[model samples]
Target: MVLEENKTSSKAPVGEFNSSDLEVGGVVVYRDRAEVKRMIRVSVKKGENDVVVNQLPSVVDPKSLRVEGEGDAIITDVIYQSKTNYDEKTKGDKKQYDKLQDEIKELVEKEKFLTFKLEVITKQRTILNKFAEQICKFSDSSKEEKADMSEILKSGSVDGVMGFLTAYQDKMSHLDEQWRMHDREKTTLTEQLNVLRKNAQDLNPTTVKDAKTNRCVCISLEAASDTDVVLALSYVVSNASWTPQYDLRVFSNDKTMKVFYYGLIKQSTGEDWLDAKLSLSTANPSIGGSVPELGVQLLKFKQPVVVSKSKRTSHRINYDELMLCSSAIGGGLQEYDPTIEDSCLEELEQKSTGKAIAPIEITTTQVETNWTSVAFNIPRMATIPSDNTEHKVTVTSVGLKPEFEYAIIPRMSSHTYLQAVVKNTSSYALLSGPANVFLDNNFVAKSSLKDVSPSEEFHCSLGVDPSIRLTTIPVKVLRGQSGLISKSVTVDYRHMFEVKNTKQEQVKVTLSEQLPLSTDERIKVHLNDPDVRKVNTPVNLPFGTVTLNSSNNLDWVVNIPTNTTQPITLTYSVEYPPGHVVQGLPKN
Candidate 1:
């Protein structure tokens, strides 16, 4: 990575000066910290040379700094120190910021003036309208040939009154036109002011310490002979990261789901990663080394740990401290533990920002992802700014065959839900992320995906399915009366469920219904039906054993053939002592 040739100047009595040979060549963005790799190209003379790379981020962890070169030179020491470049730039930007503030003030004052002008015009128009209405009334009453003389002479003769009204009418018309012009101008100015304000906000550095001074790492080299030195310096930087994003487009007709893998990258580490090669990973240098610690532990039963009921907000806001996993300069360790909480507050955060980012067309080579933690080597050079905007990037796309089914819980909801059960066939671990679901190219709603390992099957709701019709009705009503045999009351109830599948494909349905339970012996409830039809669940599954819950509820996982109607009946009866009404019995 040869940046440029070496040059020396005697203007500042330069014995050891900063070199312009260093350039940010690549960046490996992780869940938190980003590893910035810089290339230093220098032509070394046959002597000891001291050169510094002045374009390093201030958030660079001191322990994560590394420098190595391939030339006739031995790397001695690398030091990170403060300089005046960043401070000087900050001072220049402050002046521009002040100028922008003045512009905003001027715009605000102009808006106020224009608003007041519109108010005055409005008042004048109102007064003219009232006078015109009175004139109309006088004209209407004069047909009697005997109008009120006092009203007629209020503004002198009739001609005089007419001329006064006419002149004021023109005046009001002109004022209305002026108001329209002023309103347009005010709107334009307000928009301009808003854009400038947004620019001002984006231009300001995120951290005061980073903006204060230039933090550069300098290295001294002892050259054995004259040669061109190729050096690579890599350091860990904060305030820059990437998280997973996904788009699931379901082709209902084709019975397939297209999953688009995306990356939401934000860089606020002060320096722009312009035209730098990018590699997004789940690696984190903060957790620990790559080597696993093996220790013996005994498992014993104890009191369960009480987890907090509150959401883990730190997963969205805070990051763990960076601890370097570097054993040496060039040779380092990678410990991957992605710390991103992607799906929880994505909608809320997006609403707060008031900005929209269009989805990127996901594309990547087949070799981009691998086992365990996936790595995406971006093919093209990227220029990511430091405004903390979520820049979208393409990763990969996969088409999956999913089994679509309709599920109903009549006890809970009257609506039927469409669920897709798909296997995650890709090698990449699908970190939990917010997903936008589309059915046949029409956007359905916003949903989320759970963390699923490769080859694991997971299901997500795709919202209500209107094609499948379902209805639940009571066939037999609950009745209780005292019997002669034993002064007890008995009630019988039956609930019937009918499902009509309209789809062309054969679908499996899962329906759950509950029955009343009796904890006390005197208030026992018995099911009237002798036996219920057994479900043809998979042989590998142990769904044949039906154990009603202690709550007296049981789930029925049934399969409904395509283009057909299926009716299921659940019958039960409750009996209690006379004068002791059964509470679980339905009124119907």
Candidate 2:
């Protein structure tokens, strides 16, 4: 006989499970559907013993008894209470175990997914850190890179790693566009700030207009004449945010007189205003009179007068019939007005009080002119009549003016005349007779004069020889009783002289004694050589030695020897007596 049994197994589906056997309470179990379908299977070909059933004693527990059959048998518990207790305990415990196992499996799977997400996030964080580090390094390299880094960093977002990256890219693009738009604005604002700072530095604290202060101006005018007029006007400014450029309009009644525009204060130093003037012919003749009384008005501004692309304003000052006067009364007034004098004094006092002080005064005088006369004694040159050799006649004076303008006139012969006008006044009077003249120690001519005045005239005559010689005429004048008079003028004279070669072979002469000398010394020199003739003294020698020339009548001849290397010695002496020393020295 075959017996059937029902079985239950707690395992996964066959395909889902890895193993078919299972252990429960130290018992290994196989998962098989055939075993579960049948409780026993019998084989009939094999011999099997028959089983007899007997009544068990009441002392044996029926729950512990079991039976073995030749074919598998299904055992049924007779003790239902005990089976029911076992089933209840097993079912409760198994259900709890299965629940715990399912919970652990689910937790493990969740942990694996979390770990994968952590890895991805960590990797992304590392890339971001590296990118930030590279950006920092590049910024530190140069100014250009620093600017680029600023742009990049400004675009970064504070989101999750990948989201932050995408946001950062989008932000970077947006930031680049903003920079292009705002760059010009930012530059303009910066330049304006700099210009404001510079202007503040250059400006002074105290100015014509202040935001938090009040100001006042005082004007005063003085009238010189009754017709002179004066007028003034003023205006009040309020709530001026900036020192605005404005155009001021001036009017007379309803007529527009002038317009003035205020310039930039930064380029200007003072307050800008327009001043005008008008004349009054009559006080009140008619409303539309030809010459009307002067009227004045002012128009202030509250808005800026913008001068585009221009630095200076075009406003100009208008001056109407403005007349300047000096006198107070007219020419028709006859006598001096006492009231006018008092008014003038009062005006002067007021002006003096308003101004500075004046300086002190000192006295002065003029000079007077004094006059004197002068005379000179001239020497006359002797002429040689015998030999056909022409002789030079010269008249020289010692005390005469060295430089004087003179007109020489020959009273004897008007045809062969000589005239010299003495422009220079001297301290001595003129001589009476003819006088000899010598120039550069040579005979020149003779001159004679009767008298000489302040701008007097003198006369002289001369004969010139063939030889040319340089000569200067000298004159001697007497000392006057008056003070010394010096005059600078040109000396004019008609005279000529002959020059002869006096130098010959060297001559040696000896002198015994020195001769008496005078200021005007006339002498004749003779030489031992036949070719040598008489000649005047070459120069004025001092009254000391006689070794330079051989004295012959207070004179000496100088000559040079031909083909002779030896030098010639001339012995001469001079004796100058003490003469009257003229107080005034003659001016040359």
Candidate 3:
């Protein structure tokens, strides 16, 4: 697409070397790279006019550079190169570097002078301390010696001993004040030297190798007529990137939630994007755009190979590495895999530089969805500095109606967990990311959200809910032998669970329990208490409805009344031939 041009009041005179005033007009940040668009308006002559655009980031990919313009101008050719100013010592950055060095040298000299003055004051103070000690010793001497000292002082002083002491006090006070002033000066000089030295280092020769070595674009365009042409230049840079984040605010009373979507951007591209139009995309250009092709598969007979035990090795895939490969193959971020070890994941997260941002209310932005990706246009102009810090911007937020229910697995834990099922109603697609869940203005838990499309539903688990209490009664196992003639064996099992709701309003709970499934051909299993065989067939009880799923798990959906308790009982038995053992049975 052709870039949109902005108008400018300044123009270049004809037949003159003109440097274009390029400003960053827009930036579209992707998963691992960013596309920067610059705009300028310049007047051109009838023939070919050479326009030079300098101060481009060094990380800009020259291959991806493109120039588009409007007005009566035919673009000829563009030359991209790194403009090095290493030899021009009297111009631009070299002069600045020299100035910084001079300032630093001057400050260092002043610092040395202050240090000398402070040393002199310290010596004077030390002499004054010695004189005071001598006078104290004279005052503690015998009366005859004291009298002799007084006579000597009176003979030498024009005033008296008191006047002599006053003079000494005045001199000491003056020295102390001078020392304080010199110390303050020294501190100020040290601070100035630090600042100047830092500035000089930034402008040093290596800076010329890095920062001053800028990418420049020279465009030679032919104008059909003398007119002002608006040019838009775009290029891709690899140093800027963004990742998706989310905030889920749940309202339990209304059964609704608001999902705030954000993009965390980090860029160190050596150029500040000030008040530029910003957009976030889910595309990762680093993995390339070519579709992968598969070769024909050939079948061969299996062969066995033997190896020494000492020479054999085992290689296991790491969770983070596997996830990284999966994300690369998926074209975007992949869903969170719970199979990853929590300790490993937590350690990796702790080591990451990206920090969690506090939640805030935000307005939704405009979204554009395509067949393969989606882009969000920020509503206002964004300013991102060259410092590599996470700058989070609100992409969009949507209010979703959620279905809330409590899930209880008494076999694993007695605590009941609240879960919410939400459907994406907005036009923007949701990428996989970490989400912070807040319940009625209080933070409850942190959950991971999977990639979801518009009109798709996903579930989020809010941590344990203490309002509903659950108790699992101990299971009773009755082992006996039946059919004496055939010598058969039968084992009976019984389980009971108690659920109590303490809330003022009724709550829905899903209680799940596991039952043993026989793998042996001679073993027979039967449900004696609550007979059920078909799936989705509800067995209605006084408190709830029970359903036996294909996984040999019994799920009960119960609506417990306020301040009431409900009890659920499950009974089953296993029949096997004599001298045969049964596994997976409860120990107690």
Candidate 4:
């Protein structure tokens, strides 16, 4: 019995079936070439009975089958238990799939509803467009009507249109208004979004980091020593996030108090850059206003200053020695150095400490003394005794200290007198007695003195002969045993002497003379033809030897020969016994 396997068109061999063609509950089989050929032939022979043929078993008796002609075949049963199981699973899957299909259909219906709503909205938009066109047409038709309509709309009035049209128009207007408001809201929201975006973009991390990475430092001058100066550095971070560290140093070229400040600052943010500033000030005191204008300029500082070295020199003067010499020259002496004291020396020391020092040696030089004299003439008529007689006169020096001399002379003025100060080196005062004074070999006057002190002074008036040829008055002083003594010393004192010559012609005469005379002896002379010559004779001649009984006149006579210009001389002697005590002249 050769049972043929039938193949259905839709259910042919399941060889390498794709998922699109394969179905659940189907069976597949692997077959050799001969079996496949045989199956195909059998399906062709019983096309209409393929189903029945497939149900029959395909058999060529295995024992009679040639191994060469037979090949192994893998059969897939389309209706076996596996097929049943696969069919049952497929049926269950179909039910679940149908449920899912129903859900998809519901979602499709909802999408159709939303599409219909979109279509309605489109139709409404068209209607609104038509209404807007009508409104534009009306507005264009008449300006007055358009203005009225615009005013009514602006006033929120909707009474102009008919009922349903009004309602639809109102709905449409409401929708339009809502759309416009929404658009405005959207525009505002968009603008805000743009601003936020811009702000976000502008936030640059690099720039912020750089700002936080830098700092500045400043150094200020504090103080200085001989070799180095101290400075204080203040570090300031521009950004608060940064703190800086600095390495500070001072540099200078000067050996004393010279310095410069330098430093580097690093940001605490670990940055690589720094900045700094430096300021300097001096420690010296400004000059005071007490100095003179020029002196202040001299003391002005032109550059930076360091320590100052004193350059002062000491100067000294001996007030005591100067006083002594000055007193000896008739200078008035007063107490000196009473104002200088220890306090003054201390002040001087303090002042000199900072000043330039200099060595000073002082030596004293004396001031010289000067003396001057002026004279006036005394007239012959002004003589003390009116009678013209030759007498020995004396004049005592006056008005000056001891050791000084003076001379009495006739002045040029009539009846005037002249006196002269004489230089003296002696330490004693001068004294004399009354004797005859002469001028031009003629008698002039007489002089005398009493007691006078060294510091005391006096004034005298002497006579001159108008007829005598005399330029000065000649006075005589008798040297006494008692001499003058000087009492005091002085510095630079002055004595004034005055002389007067009465005669018109210049008269020449011996100014002073010394004579020896007695205290009471009187000598007289016989004047032969005395009327031809004027005689200024002394009242008493203290030296002579003659008979007193002979009219108190002397036998000695001075003869005046006619027309002769010879001067006469007479000699007389006086004696004072020895062993007489004499007092020294008074100081003046």
CA-lDDT, candidates in order: 0.67, 0.26, 0.75, 0.26
TM-score for each model: 0.56, 0.13, 0.62, 0.16
The total number of steric clashes, by the backbone 3 Å criterion, in model 2 comes to 57
Task: Identify the runs in model 1 with alpha carbons over 4 angstroms from their true place.
Answer: 1-22, 83-212, 284-363, 366-372, 475-493, 514-553, 572-588
Candidate 3 lDDT score at position 201: 79
Q: Model 4 — which ten-residue stretch has the worst lDDT?
A: 27-36
Candidate 1 lDDT, 133-241, residue by residue in tens? 5555554454332244344344244664456565765666676788799889989988998998887775565434546455665566777888888888888889998
lDDT of 1: 0.67
> Could you tell me the lDDT of residue 185 within candidate 3?
83
Error of 4 at 12 (Å): 18
> Model 1, residue 489: what's the lDDT?
76
Residue-wise C-alpha lDDT for candidate 2, range 156-231, written one tens digit per residue: 4223223544454554454345444445544554555455444443332322122122121111112232222111
C-alpha RMSD values across all candidates: 23.1, 65.2, 23.9, 65.3
Model 4 spans > 4 angstroms off = 1-90, 142-161, 164-169, 173-588
True-vs-predicted CA distance for residue 201, candidate 1, Å: 23
Cα displacement (Å) at residue 543, model 2: 99
Candidate 4: residue 83 Cα off by (Å)? 9.2
Candidate 3 lDDT, tens digit per residue, 456-547?
99999988989999988889999888884887788999999899999998989999988778898788888986777787788887777889
Question: How do all the candidates rank in terms of TM-score, highest first?
Answer: 3, 1, 4, 2
Question: Which candidate should be chosen as best, given lDDT against the real structure?
Answer: 3
